[model samples]
Target: MSPRKSVAEALSTRAAILERSVAIASAEGLEGLTIGRLAGELGMSKSGVLGHFGSKETLQLAVLDRAGEIFRAEVWEPARPAAPGLARLRVLCEAWISYLERGVFPGGCFFVAAAHEFDGRPGPVRDAVEARFDAWRGRLRKEAGRAVDAGELPGGTDPDQVAFELLGAVMALNHALQLHHDPRAPELARRTVQARLGRPAAVTGQVHRDPPEPTTAPER
Candidate 1:
């Protein structure tokens, strides 16, 4: 093959490998991804799979990167155009729920599975997962701050606290959907978020204009 053809083919093969790697990691955790298994699944030789990533750790990191791309495209980008403040935050949360509910990954959210799998392990994989989580939480916090500034939320609201609670609700949603097969988990999560943010319950399709009341709700 010509040099151009060779480069094109190599790129195509790499994309295919990464695509399959993401799916496998989502369903089986990053540890379950092996060159032999991937090669067999893709009908390629182990050497072929190894040639692209060189090592299992590198392959896992690549899969994590691919998962992030998928998340941004499917979840973040869809909510990016919404006006800032509560509107944008609400859209972002809805997009996230939709992403999980629609089965973007065969195993639900890739990061959710990976987080549970690698939470105790200390390695580059764990670092990557932690970084993603931190970034996501930071974005949520920033949006919460914006909402506060816009008066959509109470002026004294704690953005980090709000972000924390929202993240917790999402984590619960994932667990309920994956472990208990709860069909109402997403709706419940949406309502939980709406209530947390001082918005009217989503089931009513109404917005509350008053500031959120102080409550002794337990932190999730």
Candidate 2:
């Protein structure tokens, strides 16, 4: 094959590997991603999988990066064009809940799974997860601050506090879906977030929102 073709093929294979790795890590945690396991799943040799990633740590990091990309695409991109302030923030929260409900990851949220897996361990993996979370929460706080400035939320409202409450609702949604398989978890989260932001009751009505489309990603 031409050098360009070889490089293109390599990139394609690597993307496929990372995609499957994200799903596996979401369901089984990053520790479950092994060269041999991926090789078997992808119908490639162990050395082939290792050739792309070099090591388990490198593979884990790549999966984390891929997960971040998926999050931005599914969660952030959809809400980016909404009118800035509480409207944008509400759309962001709804997108997040939809991301989880749609099963973008087999195990719900990749960050949530990886965070619990590496929360106690001191390593590059944990650091990567922490950094992603910090960025996410920071965006939430920034939007909340904008809402306050726009008078959507009370003048006395603390952006950090609102971010915390919204983040808590997401955590609750993850727990409810993963533990009990609750179908209402996402809607419950939506209502909780709307209440926290003080959106009008008529706007938060159940009939107003459509359910998230089911995801094509693999399930556990």
Candidate 3:
């Protein structure tokens, strides 16, 4: 094959590996990933699979990165167009719940699984997992702070506290889903978040209402 074609094929193969790796890691922890299994599943030789990522740790890290991309696409991107503050935050919460309900990761939330798997292990893998969660919570806190500044939330409201509550609800959702296989878990999570956030700020141009007639019917 020409050099360009070879490079294209290599990229394609790498993409395939990451795709499979994310799904496997989601359901079975990152440790479950192995060259032999991936090669057998993808019909590639062990060397070919290993060639894409030189080491198991490297492959695990790559899987975390790929899973983060998928998370952004499925959850974050959908909420991007909403007006910031409570409106955007509400959209984000909804999208996040839907992402889990839709099984984007096959094992529920990839980061959640990763966090549980690596929360204690002290290593690069654990650091990567922690970083992902930190970014998510940071975004939540930023939006909550925006809501406060915009007067959508009470002035005394703590953005980090809000982030913690929201994260707790979704974390419970993942637990219910993976443990009890509860069908109502998503609905419960949505309600919990909505109650905590209260009413979302109405988006301008989202609805139209006719002008109200005068109480005294004007001069008629």
Candidate 4:
């Protein structure tokens, strides 16, 4: 093959490997990934599979990266165009529900499974998983804060708490779908999310307080 063609083939093979890796990792946990297994399933030689990633850790990291890309495409990008603050947050939540409902990964969300599998472990893989979760929570928190600033969410609302609850709701959706196979899980999650966002948080500590009422009524 020409040098250009050889490079193209190599790229194609790498993409195929990562695609299969993400699917396998989603259903079986990242630890379930092995060069030999992937080689057999993809019809590639063991050496060929290992040649792309060099080691299992590298392969796992690559799979996490690939899964992240898919997640952004499915869950984040759809919400990107919405108005920032509550509008964007609402869109993000809706997309998140759809992502889980559609079963984007053969096993629910890839990060959810990876999070459970790697939570107790310590290493690059575990760090990668944690980092992804942190970033996701940060995004949620950021939008929630903006909503509060924009007077969309109650001033009393805690963005971090909102982020936590939102993440928890979707995580529960994953659990219900994966473990109990609950058919109402998606809609149930939607209702839970909507209710959580719709209800104003009660005043708690020093940081939370009710928004002051408008001094004068003018516009309709």
Candidate 5:
């Protein structure tokens, strides 16, 4: 039997391969990322591709995981420094659109492509994708909760509903952008979300502030 790869080495190689797989998927859609293409791109044999992932399904799952990591780095982690609340929620909504606009996937968003590909399929690939969905939705809800706490949004704002709307808007823009290379659809979505939930608020028990008076110059 061939010698076993060390744990550390195996992990490192897997990471590299997963990263490369995403780049291929981003360029050619997940369907385009075949063992042959990956092998050629990575300068490895088809057998080597099989070594990291014994099957295409397994490779798909690994790609999703690595893609999630990329998403976190590009969007989620950056939002952490923003104070939690409607502002954070607003920032997150914009950030997601920006990520799509930035074109992490040359083909468009990976999650968007995978969701359509696996919509009706029941398997580890779908399961893995759903796991990431749950995480994203959860983050939205948590961010919404902060908005409500800070009075940036209506006290009655439903975090789940808010998150859903935001996510749906992103999807709408994603399709629009993919079709026409226009950015407005998603930007509109983000603006709508912020307009709905974000604003300067009076203190919990204080009266609303009036508009500021215009300043006048006595001498020119």
Candidate 6:
């Protein structure tokens, strides 16, 4: 077999640069993230950082994609195992708020921060960030529909509206927790989502658990 790829392999190189971009963008907004700044912070040569991304816009898009991947892993995946209905809805909301509360980045949510930065700026970066934002909105609608299908939520619920509200709630708490670094705002957001979905206020996080086995520990 061929030798293993180097640590600076193409994919690894891109990932490393994207991670650095995310950190810079999160702290100082996208404007503050430049090829030079990233290279300087990462202690890599300017040409080294440029070699991976090729251009500033490409780097921004890469950072946005990487941030979305991070969000899905930390927030979406954990909440996915929850029963696809009210239970799942609560889990998803709590997962979102808790992620922001934990301060995954110094600046708050990567998506939320990026939205404001790129929102009116015309370019690939704006398109990419907006697309990522809308993707979460769509995911929310799908989950909300599951709730209606199971009769866990009131019938005739508007998936679009519910999706919008959940997004708003997450953003509201994201703003507060990041600006003030207060625990209460995040807690309030989490509880509000639970209450809206008729879930208990325990915030157990048990909803994200694996499905139960058919039998308790196979008989010997």
What TM-score goes with each of the models? 0.89, 0.90, 0.91, 0.89, 0.80, 0.85
lDDT of 2 by residue, 58-149 (tens): 99999998888788888877766666678778888888899889998899888988888999999998888888888788778888898899
Residue 99, model 5: Cα distance from true site in angstroms: 0.8
1-220: candidate 1 lDDT, tens digit per residue: 8999999999999999999988888888999999999999999999999999999999998888888888887777655666666777887788888887888888888888988899999999888888888888877888899989998898899999999998888889888888899999999999998897766324443343433321110100
Query: Candidate 6: minimum summed lDDT over ten consecutive residues — where?
Result: 211-220
Q: Report residue 196 deviation for candidate 2 (angstroms).
A: 0.7
lDDT of 3: 0.83
Q: For model 4, how does the per-residue alpha-carbon lDDT over 1-220 read when each residue is reduced to its tens digit?
A: 8999999999999999999998899899999999999999999999999999999999999999888888887887776666668777887899889988999899988888888898999999888888888888888898899999999888889999999999889989999999999999999999998897774344333222223321100000
Per-residue lDDT of 107 in model 3: 89
What are the Cα lDDT values of the candidates? 0.81, 0.83, 0.83, 0.84, 0.71, 0.74
Count of clashes in candidate 1: 0
Q: Candidate 6 clashing pairs?
A: none
What C-alpha root-mean-square deviation, in Å, does candidate 3 show against the real structure?
A: 11.1
Error in Å for residue 199 of model 2: 2.4
Candidate 4 positional error at 177, Å: 0.5
Better candidate number, 2 or 4, judged by TM-score: 2
Output the better candidate (3/6) by TM-score. Answer: 3
**Winner on TM-score (1 vs 3):** 3
Candidate 5, run of 10 with poorest lDDT: 211-220
Count steric clashes of candidate 2.
Answer: 0
Report the lDDT tens digits of candidate 3 across residue range 1-220.
Answer: 8999999999999999999998899899999999999999999999999999999999999988888777787777666677768887898899888888888778888888887788889999888888777778888888899999998899999999999999999989988998899999999999999898896645575532323321100000
Clashes of each: 0, 0, 0, 0, 1, 0
lDDT of prediction 4: 0.84
RMSD of each: 7.2, 6.1, 11.1, 10.3, 11.8, 7.5
Q: 2 or 6, which is superior by TM-score?
A: 2
Q: What residue runs in model 4 are displaced by over 4 Å at the alpha carbon?
A: 199-220
Candidate 1 ranges beyond 4 A from true positions: 198-220
**How does candidate 4 fare on TM-score?**
0.89
TM-score of 6: 0.85
